[model samples]
Target chain A: MSEKGIHIEEHRDDEASKLGMWLFIFTELLLFGGLFLVYSIYRWQYPVNFHEASLELSVTIGVINTIVLLFSSMTIAMALTAIQKNNKKLALRLIAVTLLMALIFLINKYFEWGHKFEHGLYPGSDLMALLERGHLLYFSLYFFMTGLHALHIIVGMILLIIAYFKVKKDSVNSDRFVFLENGALYWHLVDLIWIFLFPLMYLIT
Target chain B: MDHNKTHITEYKVLAKILLLLIFCTFLTISITSFNLAAFTVTIALLIAGVKGFLVLSYFMHLKYESLLLRILVGSIFLLFIIIVLITFIDYSFR
Candidate 1:
């Protein structure tokens, strides 16, 4: 037999990578799940306080943010489609659109939190300290869950920017785009958390 | 083995899903004006659940994923519900 050269095959498993992304998603879900559990128990205990506290949140802004996040989710999903179709420019543009929407969401959030601060509604304020137990729990969970959610948004934006650069460098291309795909999944998870949070915190009145 | 071509969701489909989600959002807000009493939160949550499902199946493309992944994701949600239910039961009887 003729001597054969050693063939070094580069390891690749997109499915495994995606599965890993989902497992991480499971953890994320559970983490938020714990918070949601806390929210339910407290809300049940202090239904009236939760109701009045939720009324303090502007439905107009919550509605706007919901639309913004849903729109961003669509754009990111469309970006995946664009990449698959070899339309790199369209994909990047869609990603840019998604990022813009994320910025808009944060801006709205900033104004919303600013409104709260103006009223001494923030945690650790003397006003908060004087609030009754149920009302206090409501604001604390509000700051905690929404703050955690905003932190996730920042992280997702960073991930998308990195994925954007990877795609720009052609390190993640049409044929191999799982990295970008996973980032989009994480973005969707952010949207998912807000979907629950919006009604629980804003519309439950 | 030849790798099958990945499914590419149509841009139009994604746009439609967004519209549907927006409609659902409006629907929730509209329902708020009504005095459904305790049913208000329940209805809002149901709509949110629907929105979550749409985002999961379409935006995240979980619908097209393999059965194993689907079952796994489904079970995780089930477990979350179970945990919440158990906690509620404990607190309710206490």
Candidate 2:
């Protein structure tokens, strides 16, 4: 079918693509897992400071964000189901809802971080430097872990956006939905990391 | 497209799973208010692990994946645990 009368094949192996996505997710898990290891060790060394620092965090906001993410995860999962059922309209609507949830979550995080900045609680700030080593480490890990997770949220949002467009264009449907599936997988991974982060950062005893 | 191989998870089941996750989250938060000391982290993590499993199996559809894929995923977690344990041993002695 080419200009030279030679046939060319389009590589569209869905299973292989999904496998690659899962492998990428494995690396992400390990990346965050290492940070978690560091957090556990430091918490062991300075339990009291970590506890006190954790108390300073707004549990109400943390809980709200957790609920938002859980709901968003459900919406994305539902979006996949919609597409599987060949309901493009419902799928697009669900994806839109998921995107809105992501925005709400980031907005809440912005305000939460803004409040901390107002109190001069950021890493390398004078207030943080004045604190003991344990408190310093606590805030440092807090920012690093949550910050990384937020970055993932942004990336996942982009993926969902692409999936949204693909679904609209008919490139991804019930028969060809690997793109959407992978995007949902990425979103779920984001939610999963937050599941652990909520406990470690917000529920410190 | 292997239509026969694809699994279409029901919406009701997904909703139920989400409800369970939310319940577990609340349970974790409430339990932390009590003074369980060292056991608090363990309990919180255990609940989180359950929630993670639910998301993986239901939301991510890992439950319907091939055995090779499942093993690949499982081995990653296993290796991570082994690494964590080895590190704990070193830290404990020091």
Candidate 3:
């Protein structure tokens, strides 16, 4: 009860909050699911061209980014464990590690995209206009999917940043860390998407 | 306070899961070296599906979540699969 005549209670619901996040996650899954369907249909329609284009991508960079994102997911998961145990410092450090890994993943992406750009492989480039229809579709899907994934990583970074500050302020302590949980959930979702993207975009035919 | 009792996953467990995930990734890369024909992409995607299950279950704490929540999540994936199948069926027939 407050000093004012009217009394209002503080409301908090973690399950509902988490449910909300999961619902959003479902929507996100289908959004990418649509893209995956398009990719699969095209790969079916033009297997030879898809195989050749997949060969052009750098497997080394794709593998490195895969490992980096996996490591970051582990760190973020452990950060929640740390927070659960009331180890704020360790949680902070773990989140920092995750942020660093994200930067490393982006840096690798920069080099990879930079190399492709140097060869005029990006969308709308003169060289792209001259490529076969199938190859063009492959690269177009490549850019759109990976570019959207990168944007997600940036958004996850922002959520983590907010969670970091909240943790520091003790607003999201051991008892109330749903914000952190949701952020970590988002991060894991990003990693989940990459698990499939890495192979589809870089490996196989 | 949260609804369920707090279940703090061990750091070591997360590390182990990470190791397993990395091993799966290596397997994915290793298989690409061999010319398995059309089976190659199938294997790659299968491995990816397994890896995705791990991330969803362990990393995302879906396993620890309430049964209702788990069912809801599973149903969403099921719905997505059904849509994909219908789309494919339509495309292939057309």
Candidate 4:
């Protein structure tokens, strides 16, 4: 009954894109919700073991990665501002910064996970040595949940890289900056996951 | 719209403020590791909530968006909290 658009027609594409991103965000919440439920069950069953297992994590590394992500979040905001200003060059530069920050985040995670792996702390493999007595399930969930989150981060980074190139080629504009905007939303979701993860996995002792 | 270029500079300043927030997060984590009280998780979550709001408002452009999108996003967050609250009550009783 109602029409929407720049001309006589409606901007179905714009509204659809926003709806899609929101729906994707809902699914992501549920995905992480499952992991959170598992974590909750495990912690309730074995609080002591969970406490001990948390000590094995390098908070130093986690904090560093958090800051790295925070900076990237800032860069992406700048990128969006550049887009609003129609400064494609500045937008591209900011996107490059975001991509670089993401790589650094992954690099830090590599060593963090690598350390745990070296110490025989993997999911469903050999977590007995990780905790004091009984937290195999706990550590397993930690790795599985965090591992899955890290995978999402990697995917998000690739998306940011694509956004960088797309913006560089003048493909992103006020009319079609939906891709860039949604990409930023996806990146922020990744950041939001870590915001919860940092406390749940690290500070819950 | 062209006159709003001033907001571009504001965005950069926010970026710098985010760097400071990161430093605060690092400090919070480091101090937490050194055997803080039961407030460690609370403090960490508070810092995180602040950071999340900053991103949601500034980075996601919610601040500049219409009330419709804001209501949408707010309802989602409200739903999330309600779900968590109800579940926590059930779990705690168990």
Estimate TM-scores for all models: 0.96, 0.96, 0.96, 0.84
- What is the CA-based DockQ of model 3? 0.78
Q: Which predicted model would earn the best DockQ?
A: 2
List, residue by residue over B1-94, the lDDT tens digit for candidate 3.
Answer: 4444967889988999999999999999999789899999989989998999899888998888889989988998898789888988999999
- Write one digit per residue (lDDT tens) for candidate 4, span B1-94: 2223223336757666687677667766676666565576667667777877777777666677658878877887777667767877888897
- A85-159 in candidate 4: lDDT tens per residue? 788888888898898888998898889888877877676554455445446766777778888888988889888
Please give, for every candidate in the order listed, the TM-score of chain B alone compared with the true chain B.
0.93, 0.94, 0.89, 0.74
Q: Against the hidden true structure, what lDDT does model 1 obtain?
A: 0.92
Per-residue C-alpha lDDT of model 2 across residues A168-191, encoded as one tens digit per residue? 999999888989999999999999
lDDT of 3 by residue, A1-205 (tens): 7677677757988889999999999999999999999999899889899989999988989999999999999999999999998899999999999999999998998999999999989989999999999999999999999999999999999999999999999998888889999999999999999998999988855
Worst 10 residues of 4 chain A by lDDT: A2-11
Name the runs in model 1 displaced over 4 angstroms: A1-7, B1-4
Cα shift from native, residue B81, model 1 (Å)? 0.8
Question: Which 10-residue window in model 1 chain B sums to the lowest lDDT?
Answer: B1-10
i-RMSD of all predictions: 1.1, 0.9, 1.4, 3.3
**Candidates 1 and 3 compared by TM-score, better number:** 1
lDDT by residue (B17-76, candidate 2, tens digit) is 999999999999999999899999999999999999999999999898999998998898
I-RMSD for candidate 2: 0.9
After TM-score superposition, what is the CA distance of residue A27 in candidate 2 from its true location, in Å? 0.5
